[model samples]
Target: MSILVFVEQRDARVRSIVREVLGEASRLAAVLGGPVVGVCPAASDPGLATLGDAGAERVLLAAHEAFARYDAAGYTLAVVAAIEAVKPQVVLFGASAMGRDLAPRVAARLGVGLATDCTALAADGGRLTATRPVFAGKAIQKLAFPRVPALASLRPKVFAPAAASGRTATVEPLTVGFDPAAARAKVVRMAAAAGARVDLTEADVIVSGGRGLQDAGNFRLIEELAEALGAAVGASRAVVDAGWRPHSEQVGQTGKTVSPKLYVAVGISGAIQHLAGMSSSRCIVAINKDPEAPIFKVADYGVVGRFEEVVPALIEAVKQLNAQV
Candidate 1:
């Protein structure tokens, strides 16, 4: 009943979401009377050792020339091979761009059920229970899977990383066969957006503006507040479509999903599509002149006022808070 966690690498380092997945996998594995194992592609990835420290009993390195760049087919093959070798009872992956595309393929190949964008996972009475939002974040549904090697792709930041275990794992290198060129889609190049402050999914704090901002330059106020709190600046689809912000900075069903510790929504009316993406955030703060804005329905705190007046005050408050800290 061992658990297998797919650890992701970004810029040769482990992505922050990997640690959260480790914590979740460890808890589930402990309950199932199995050890948690971490799997990652090997190619001078500095994240392997860190995965072990996060609580994996062993770190399985899948090193092959094909894995240097992410070939969904190649990675799928490698994960399938690793699962066959380890015989894990449950598999976990962060529901990121890679995981969303990769996990389903592996699950389909294995002929197993897979839960995507799961907010919570648990092993109860010898079955895996997956909890996720449904009906556009208006409700939550819990499902149980009976098949062995249950697969799940978890939402980032929903689970917190546990304290470091300091346990060194037996690193096993996996050997598999796959052709990168055979993949239908090949990653040729990656271009980082200039002056992007945060990776939306990984940000602990997010300050987002919406149609209420009225214009793009108004986003600078959101950025200033984010900077003061060491947070990330985000925008709703309306703002992005209006060219008030970059699409990469948009957080909604049509864009990137995020579950930050603290989420500040400015001028957003809380459309269902927008809520679907960030409803899982730990704390939600809404600032809109319209008290009737739908966002306040789910907001933990609400400041009903015009953004031009409210945002500056919030920024000043955050600056003072930082000074005190």
Candidate 2:
């Protein structure tokens, strides 16, 4: 009947994945000629009302004390309840950590098929289909859903956030009768590092460094350039393993997979493991002293030079470009 979008929030803030999912939902809704309904779990968050700007005609909010913090059981049940009510032909979620954890539970509860980490969606022949990378992004597979209420989780940044429509959304209260005793895992407290980082998975642009940086001190090169470019700082697994950077900043098979619009690799001799994580990035620029590095094979732009010599110049150049803007 409608396209149901799961709105994910954290620390009282709406996550970018939610907006990204909404943008895709808007596109899908256009194809299906259906209205977009957003389902949010929480008490009245002021931010939850903004989904209308992203294409929601109406929002169903389940505001309750049990939803103040995430309880896997409580949240899952709330979503299932919303799904049962909406009875939509398609559902959309961002392929975020929360979405990955929750989408499966909802799909199982509804006895529906789900496609995870989808990079693309198509309205083909009056039906929706999804495409995802397989074999660690080395291959692509298109999926067709044979049932109504088919679920799909989108990879962040694959679609631009929809422009705000400047219309106020009608918010309705959703009822979630959650029982705390059913939840085994509970969030007690949350702490952040002194400096909050732009998560690699969510960042639109990333500047990552590797072992060729020589030591932790040289990481300033990556940081400075990232600052100039308004990009997140990422690190190769080698740099993280060597204690040159935090594990949270690591990007590779063992770390976070990112598909940012722009990815800059500095001194990272690209290993297959690392490529698998970021190969889907829209634009990749690799800088290395060794031109023969495997990273050059996949990089859209390659620079053969010492990062120390090149990064400062690049940072200055970016500053100049920004000043012009």
Candidate 3:
């Protein structure tokens, strides 16, 4: 038995989340007693030998022309084929945009239970349990799998990537019978966002603003702070709804969930919906005029002041620190 990880790729390169999944799967495999395997669907080989350092004992490459772009039907077939071939004890997928789409498809196709957005996993007595946030992050739930080959999708950036061990995994080719007609939908083209910053989900550090900024034009303060800290810019739902920020930068229950190493909240009132997305960050720094703002409750550090004054001082401090380094 083995733990199988669905290795996602882009532009013929492996995604960072795959390494995190593989690392976590390796840890679980140690407790569950098995090897960790990677199942990758790509148009071409992504040179995955380095994954061995991240604890992939072996990688199954499911290469096909249909895999050039993420066709839901084709990817579902590839993952199903890999599962059938490997007969893994557990299957892990990153809870990213692609994984969120693909995981449920595979689960429905195989008629198995699926857990999405899992933040933690544990193995006991050769059994696996998954932990996830529920009720808009107000409660936590632990789930157990009654069936074998437990399926789960892990939240990105929640788990630490495995340290390199100078080991190499053996890559093997896996063939899947893909039918063109089965693909009901196809991605003809993708338009990238103009001047896109770091993906919020994958960013190590994030600086977010909310309605407390007073006006849309004031977002420049948030951007300057993010730039100074080399972090991604995020916005509260109120800001997005007000058109002060794009929906892509929104972080909350209705927006994107982020678990960055450091999360800076400026002028955000910390609505429950907003806290749902970012409460898991390793370090949270909140700056708000109201000392009683809900955001301060979860923040590791709280600064009570208006953003207009607090933000500029913080940005200057960051710049001076960067200069010193």
Candidate 4:
């Protein structure tokens, strides 16, 4: 009858999305009158003591050698085992690459319904409802679970992380055994992006550029502005299609969705696909030469001018502001 959160970690460090999921879960658990529990799969202890401050009363560690890297079959078996042992009424996962891949597999194994990419979650009268954008972000849909052990994946950066409570969670080891041959795929190695900045989905601020930049070489302007603001760099589908940026940095209906605290669109005309990904940002700033640009419709602030002239001024302004702070 507890809320179970899947704790995601990289290099023994917990992902920020886990804290976001845990924060929302804690709110739901308060209404459901249940405790919050964390389920983690790792080769060794990932230093999860801080989860208690994030609302986890207890942590379940499913230790296994295969868990060092993500193995679909191995992870599915491990998560299923944890669910079986705890029998939580609700289960939550971060809507990250790994979570998106693993949630469906776990749901299928349990034959339960799952809601993905939910931006809002609420509990009323002990019933949980999830809200997600649908129809290419043109509409919103609310979903309710008809069965126990309701499962859902939450979008990153949409919910604020829980404030520290100065509490420590009790860690317990969960025993799991799976056949090595059951894993059809194995991660041979991982290559980190060199000099990578904040992940787009997890960033608080984002600066995005589009085809209006005229050429791929102009992306350095976007990067420089992003650096000045300590933000992640994003690109529209057109830019990505032109091979100016990697698909990983693309923001659109076919790309990764984001809900950062601040979004700056430089030379972007505001395609619906691009809007679908970042419309949830708390603040939006659009800079374009044409006042009729579609992006201005949703922007909290708009500047009409060529980015070459406008961006440099904005970057200097930001630098001045940072220096004062």
TM-score for each of the candidates:
0.92, 0.93, 0.96, 0.96
Q: Name the better of 2 and 4 by TM-score.
A: 4
**Which candidate model has the greater lDDT, 1 or 4?**
4
lDDT of 1 by residue, 72-110 (tens): 888898889889988999999998888999999999999
Model 1 RMSD to the real structure? 2.1
- Superposed on all Cα atoms, the candidates' RMSDs to the truth, in angstroms, are 2.1, 2.0, 1.5, 1.5
TM-score of 3: 0.96
Candidate 3 per-residue lDDT over residues 1-325, each given as its tens digit: 8999999997787988998998899889878888898988899889888899999999999999778778788888889988998899999999988999999999888888888999999998888899998875768999999987899999988887888888999999998898876667998876984225579988999999999999999999999999999999999999899998999999989788888999999999999999998998999999999999999999999999989999999999999999999
What's the CA error at residue 189 for candidate 3, in Å?
Answer: 1.3
TM-score, candidate 2, is 0.93
- Assess each prediction's global lDDT (C-alpha) against the native: 0.85, 0.87, 0.91, 0.89
Worst 10 residues of 3 by lDDT: 189-198
Instruction: List model 4 lDDT by residue over 1-325, tens digit each.
Output: 8999999876666788899999998888888978899989888888888899998999899888878777778778778888998899899999988899999999999999899989999887788899998865768999999987999999888887788888999999988787766666888777885225588988889999999999999988899999999999999999999999999999879887788899999999998989988898899999999999999999999999999999999999999999999
Question: In candidate 3, which residue pairs get closer than 3 Å at backbone N, Cα or C atoms, i.e. clash?
Answer: none
